[model samples]
Target: MTQATAPCCDANPDPRTLRGCCIGLSVATCLLFSGATTAADSFWSTIQLHGFAAQSVIKTSDNRFFGDSPDTSFDSTEIGVNASVRLDPKVLVAGQVLARRAGDMYDGTPSLDYALTDIALIASPERILGIRLGRVKNPLGLYNETRDVPFTRPGIFLPQVIYYDKVRNIVLSSDGAAVYGSLYNDLGEFSVTLVGGWPVLDDNVQWTYLGGDFPGTLRPNGSVWTGSLWYATVTEQLRFGLSGALASLRYAPHQNDILGPGQTDIVYGIASLQYSARRFTLSAEYGLEPVRWRRYGPLLPRQKVTSEGYYLQGTYRIRSNLELMACYEEGVADSDDRDGSEFAGVTGGLVPAHAMFSKIATVGLRWDPTPNLMLRAQYQWNQGTLVLSQLENPDFPRQREYWTLLALQVAFRF
Candidate 1:
């Protein structure tokens, strides 16, 4: 599913601007059910409606991220509404519509984030099995499922190393079905999930893989297979998970194109761990993706490389409503050439070695003035430019190897 821009429901150019109307719709839906008779109250009780909106201002000493950050950009925004309803004791339906704007990567086009019908096939106090059919969020790492929701995230920005915003659309969600199971006992709880689907792809995915969009179309060659295994302590103080995916895509070139028809195969995996206490939390996730490109001719010959990313982070609550966070993270475009020296040499210095890797250290503060309002401020020191987007920073050769960034955000939810 390629999410193309479309005219708004109203006459507005961007759907994000009509968020108020969407919220009003939510309110109206709730009110309409408020007058339900006693016989119909059970159905109304099963309905749940919620929405969230967030805006952020970002400034960077150099380079572009989410926008022309060097000039103090406010190009990042998120707005969405989600609803869920129980159709029966063992059946439920849920969905979300979202509008997001992020520099050159995403426009504020309204899109279906997810829509799914979940059915429990086997239910018991100690074990359960279910399946979800329709569009569903991929359970990639620890955060991909709720990546766009500010209220559910630990910070304004998740670690770029693991969540590449430039190609987010490729991994955000998929259209198909997923089977999941969970078991509970005194030892702990264990869960497993398997999903087969076609993920939504967009221009960002093309740019990230092909360097640029040629006179051709990129489409999924087949369905993607993703799986995850997780476990948590009995006290819910510790948890860990292993997740992975296999995906493939093909290119159909034009009559006289610069490239030949090519195929891309990707193998992705992530390991996550976390520990939580009364006021402090520690977490880490490491990811590896091996990409193979084939049949692309001389200009882009067959090749394979494994990229790596990982982060270590900790958060401490200063009070019931305030928290402080610190993190260190790194990303390498190719594990075999961690310094990108071989890559730079092959390109004759046309691209710098810094373009292949990045290291960052960050500190931040988050304050919850109320249950529905959140404010956050963060500062980051970054080295290298691996995560910078080509669409947003055309002058890639001139990109600085070191930079600093500061961001402030406010979010509201209901």
Candidate 2:
């Protein structure tokens, strides 16, 4: 997906304004660096700096994955720099700045990904409790928190069924607070996290929900709430989690806009499980997302959709530095309208039926010649376009129901 400019939503910052904010971030980073060096030796010792960079090449036989991948595009890149400072034994501050370029999906713009203060109110050998304030990562299924990090993710690309790239920005992080606690016992470990915050309302989010050509702007109107509960065995070989979130937003039309005021409510839940051994790992996740839209003028009718998705993945370690993985993923835009006939009928057959569902099979390999350098290659067979980003696949009529994609990536971290 490539990032393109569009009319700003009511709560969206202007592109120019965001550029200026990036400049401010640059200055702040410099100051933080200077303070780390000039403050006290102890203070400097408490600060840590880390970063990662990655580039990928993608090619698709029928549809583009990132940019016009039909010709082998180098339109995927990710770079991030983060710093953390320990204010006290139980308090810490951390922030990350990221620049990501995904053909038509995201532009290589520097942005503050997360800046949060973590305070551990209770800490013990067997139990821990903490709160995170500010821009915090939303703990979705299993891999969301570290999804952006190549080193942390199980594969180069996560399963689109549960982690759809089209709405990544909306679910990635939130501006708010979270309370988390964990307990360790002889039998197993249990943890819980609850968060309430305002979701990031960006152009991509609007473009995903409303057609990019829509005249009105979509913005967040209310807070979002999310919670997760996780359990793992004492050896940490088996783990499972349940997570859910509720998000609300509204659309405000311009004076000349053809669309009327509209509101959207989304509720989703995910169940995840993973089993890890010395050389093999098996994982599976299932999700249900119900979305409601109301009052989009007379042009767009009210809608209620319950989408369902799931994935099963397995990985085998061939060597200390080599791993192989395969996954089967499926997603349906509406459980009741699996073929999209109802949606197409409602839209006067303007939308393709294939757009309502997607099934993908993927196989990939990862090699780490060095601890800080990683290489990955993957192939995907896709049967639908439900997870494709509208910004990337603007010409919906031209999209193919079946497509093949090949991707290769190199990543480095320090």
Looking at candidate 2, the ten consecutive residues that score lowest on lDDT are 1-10
List the global CA lDDT of all models: 0.82, 0.81
| Count: clashes, candidate 1 | 0
lDDT for position 189 in model 2: 93
RMSD list, candidates in order = 6.0, 4.3
Clashes of each: 0, 8
lDDT of 1 by residue, 312-338 (tens): 999999998999999999999999988
The true-versus-predicted C-alpha distance at residue 224 of model 2, in Å, is: 1.3
Per-model TM values vs. the true structure: 0.90, 0.90
lDDT of 2 by residue, 148-216 (tens): 887888787889889987778667877778999999999789999998877766767777666554566
Q: What's the lDDT of the predicted structure labeled candidate 1?
A: 0.82
Top candidate, metric lDDT = 1
